[model samples]
Target chain A: MIIAVASGKGGTGKTTVAVNLARSLAGPVHLFDCDVEEPNANLFLHGAVERTDEVTLPVPAVDAAKCNGCNECGRLCQYHAIASFGSQALVFSELCHGCGGCMLVCPRGAITETPRRIGVLETARSGDITIVTGRIDVGVAFAPPLIRAVKGRIGSGVTAILDAPPGTSCPVIATVTGADAVILVTEPTPFGLHDLTLAVETVRELGVPFGVVVNRVGMGDGRVHAYCAKEGIPVLLDIPDDRRIAEAYSSGRLLVEALPEYRTLFTGLWQAVGELAAKKGRATEVAR
Target chain B: MKIACTTTGNGLQSPVDPRFGRAQRLIIVDTDTDAFTVVDNAAGAAAAQGAGIQAAEAVVRAGAVALISGHIGPKAFRALRASGVKMYTTDAPTVEEAVKRFKAGSLTEAKSADVNGHW
Candidate 1:
């Protein structure tokens, strides 16, 4: 079964809930930090990175020698990535979607698909827990592609947990989709509540079963609880505001490892998730 | 010289649209003859990404040597400037007023983009 931990707003404990849940769960479990823009779960696990592979996107490269500038490729490009002027075709790699339409439409065979390194997918292991992370190169604007690259490593029969990127944008959608269940981590603040509404709408539109995990419980008001109750959404767990947890997190220590008592909490949270997914009939034939 | 002014309506009476990428229409008018053509900018306005760059390309293709708008984003600014298309900004009440300002040399040319594109 695959479970995705997501949050609408940043710094809402998505990585905390995801890493802890993956570590606490019994049997072989894989954790994918799908927040390619910034993957931090590896910091908590401190596992030696076993393997890494460069992730690349196909971008159009223009060949000046092969060209008669028909302007067909430039006109056909929806992205305006290929601009031809006075027998010269300029290919802006950053804007190319790698759709390959430019290459196909080019009458002179001037456009060729080229691989551009966008990010790297790395694997690490801490005992039975395997962590997969996508680390995007600096200045890369798109994260959905790298997120997909990390999620492609999902092994069958192993409980795969994904810590998704924040917000209701494309990257979050890519991570949250195909999950047996989704756990939305949020704080109790007003900003959290507002963003949570957007996230809930996104998952609901995708027709996925999901629940909420309130973090830093004592930091804000009860409006989040009120909103969830009004919407009939389940509040699976709440991690209280504790300075010790913060200090441990800052120093790159897992909550379950630093505070032995919280191990039970994460394990119980996993149990709740299994039950929730099972009830929704999404947890199919996955022996836990 | 042809100048393109972002407009709210098809005619010169229409208000000058401040937004460069999301403008409704681009009225390309010849400064010498006052002959003009209106290009629908809805496609760029509705584009998912690179709206500013696409609009800049449209301006370039329209044979407009200059652009008049409220703001020019970095992407469009770079493209227009690269193509030697000078850009001017105005809060003129109508497209006609903006063109008049352009003819009077009262409109200030934008040296660089005022804002970054959202996408």
Candidate 2:
């Protein structure tokens, strides 16, 4: 069963829940850090890198020699990545979405795809817990392609926890698309509640079964809880605002490892997630 | 010499648009004939990305030798430079005023992009 941990607001404990849940689970679990822009789960896990693979996107490359500038490729390119007025087509490689529509529309067959390295995937093992981190190279604007690359490494028949990027944008959608269940982490603050509403809408629109995990509780008001109750959404678990957790997280330590007491909390959270997924019939066979 | 001015409306008296990539309309004025034509730029304004590149292409295709705008992004700057089109910045309120400033050499030619992309 695959579960994606996501939050609309940054620093809302999606990674904390994802990594801790992956570590606390009893059986073999894979944690895929789909936040390719910046993968920080590895920092907390400190797992040794087992393998590294480069990720590439197939961007179009034009051949000027084939010679008739019909401008069909230019018209077909929605991104304006390729434009031809009366001469050879000008290709803006960075702007290309790699849709291959231009290549298909080219009557002269002058356009071909070439791989452009965008990011790298690192597979690491921390004891029985396997962590796959997708790290995009600096200045890479798009993250969905790299996020898809990370999800492609999902281990079969094992519980996979995807630590999604923040916001309800394309990257978050890419991460939470096919999950058995999604854990929307949030704090109790006004900012958290506002973004959480958007995140809830996003998941609901995608038709994915999701539950909320309120982090840093005891600081903000109970509006989040009230909102969830009114919407009939389950509040899976709540992690209180403790300075100790913050200090441990700051020093690159997992919460469950730093305070073994929290292992029970994460494990219980996992169990609740399994039950939630099972109730939704998303993971009947794999919910444990 | 023909020059393109980013504007809010179709007429020469229309206010000059501050944005280059998402300008509402482009007014192409012929210095020799004192005649002009308007090109609607709604497509570039609505583009998700590469709006500047597309706008630049449109200006080039309209046979403009120079561009007058409040700001130019790096991508558009490079594109216009490659096409041998000179870019100048104008604080003039209207397209006709901007053309007058361009003819009087009161406007500064941009050596590099004045603003970052998506600004």
Candidate 3:
């Protein structure tokens, strides 16, 4: 089963829930950090990076010699990254989405795709748990491709927990698209509630089975719980505001490792996730 | 010489558009013929990135020899400069006035882009 931990707002404890769940789960489990923009799960994991791979995107390189002043590529480009200027086709690599449509439509065979380094994928192991992360090179805007690259390392037969980027944007969608279940981590604050509504809508639109894990629960209003109850959304787990937890997080310690007392909490959360996913699977099976 | 002025409409009385990349329309006028053609630049206005470059492409494709706008970005400047197109910054209210100033040599010559990209 693949469980993606996501949050609409930043600093809402997505990585916290994902890492702890991975540690608490029994049997073979892999952790894939799909937040290519700012991957921090490795900082709290007990592992040295064993393998490194470069991530690249295919950007177009135009040959002016073999070109007629055809404007097809520029017209077909959705991002407007390609522009045909007289005899030259100007391609801005940063703006390219790597769709390769520009090269395919070039009638003169003048457009060739060249690889540009956008990020790196690193793999590390902490005992039985394997951790993979995508780290985008600073100043690169394209992250969904790299996020997809990191998720490609998922091995079958092992539970994969994906730590998705914050918000319900393209990157988050890419991460949570195929998950068996999604855990939306949220605080109970007003901002968290507002963004959680958006995140919930995204997951609902993607047709994924999801439940809420309310962090810093005791500190805020009960509106989140009330909202969840009203919508009949499952509240999977509630982590209270604790200074010890904060200190553990600040010191880059995994919750399962730093506080053995909370192991049962996460382990129980996994059980809840299994039940939720199983229920959804049966529902889909029955419908089909 | 053909001159391109960023404008809100197709005619000479159209208001000068302040933005080069996101300009609504560009009026390419031939000083010799006193004739003009309109090129829609709204595609650049809606572009996610490299709007300036795309807008520059539009003017270049129109065979414009000079460009008049309130502001030009670095990428647009580089693209126009590569085509040897003269750029002038103008506060003229209308496309007609901008073209008149271009001929009178009163508009400031934009030797470099006056603003950063996405400005």
Candidate 4:
């Protein structure tokens, strides 16, 4: 089962939940930190990354010498990353979506695709868990491509847990899309409840099954609980606001390691997720 | 001088709202006359693929010699500069406020909004 752990707002302990959950799961599991922009799950786990691969995007490189600038390439380019006027063909590297549309339409074959390094994918293993993390290049604009690159390394049959980026944006969507189940982590605050609604909407729109995990549970009011109950969404787990958990997190330690008793809780969470997946499969089978 | 405003919708007051699809409509305001004209972004094709050059082309065709927006991404900023279109970055509450700031020469042009990272 591929379970995605996501939050609508940053700093809501999404990574903490993800790391502990993966560590506590029985048998072999894979953990993917799909938040390419600033992946922090590795910082907490400190797994020895075994391999690294560079992710590249196809960008048009204009060969000006052979080109009669009829602007056909530019006209065909939906991205307008390439423009030809008179004798010159200009390529704006930043605007290019690497769609290769310009290369396909270049009548003079003036435009050819060259790989532009955008990010790197790192893979590591710790006992039963394999961790895949993506780090975006220092000056890249897009994250979806890198997120996809990291996810592509996922091996089959391992229960993968994706630590998704914050917010209900494209990056979050890219990470959580098509997962077997999603765990929406949120605090009990008003902002948390509001953002959780947005995230719930996004996941629902994708037709994915999801449940809520309330982090720092006792710190704020019961707004999140109220909202979840009203929406008929399951409140899967609650990690109470504990000073020991805070210290563990600040020191870059997994909660299960700090409080070994909590391992059973994560195990229970895993069981719940398995049951949910099984139910989904049965429902789909019924439809067929 | 006709300055173009990048808007989220067809109105004269929206910022670069990401919620709106890439079909950017250019709001052209004649500085001297204070009259507004909305131009269907000629570069809508660029936005279909979320390209910056197409956005720049839309603003340029709308007769804007300069652009004022909340945030301009790197690709779009480069395209705007290449086309010799002046850009101003401001978190103006409304489109009219942005135009006013541009007219008063109080808005500052900014670097691109794309966060640099390894791809």
Best by DockQ: 3
Q: Which ten residues in a row have the lowest lDDT in candidate 3 chain B?
A: B75-84
Candidate 3 lDDT tens digits, A153-172 = 88777789999999999999
Residue lDDT tens for model 3, B1-119: 89999998879999999999999999999998879999998889887678898789889889898999999998888788867788999889999998888888888889998897886
Q: Which regions of candidate 2 fall more than 4 Å away from where they truly are?
A: A282-288, B7-19, B22-24, B40-48, B68-74, B77-119
True contacts kept of 4: 0.20
* Ranking of all candidate structures by their lDDT, best first: 3, 2, 1, 4
Better of 2 and 4 by lDDT: 2
Off by over 4 Å in 3: B7-19, B23-43, B61-63, B81-84, B89-101, B104-115
Candidate 4, residue A246: Cα displacement in angstroms equals 0.7
By summed lDDT, the worst window of 10 consecutive residues in model 2 chain A runs over A279-288
Fraction of true contacts reproduced, model 2?
0.35
Q: Candidate 1 — which pairs collide?
A: none
In order of appearance, the predictions have TM-scores of 0.78, 0.88, 0.88, 0.75
For each candidate in the order shown, give its overall lDDT on alpha carbons: 0.88, 0.90, 0.90, 0.80
lDDT (Cα, 0-100) at A23 in candidate 1: 85
TM-score of 3: 0.88
- The true-versus-predicted C-alpha distance at residue B3 of model 1, in Å, is 6.4
In every candidate, how many clashes are there?
0, 0, 0, 16
Error of 2 at B72 (Å): 4.7
lDDT of 2 at A225: 98
Window of ten residues with lowest summed lDDT in model 3 chain A: A80-89
DockQ of candidate 2 is 0.42
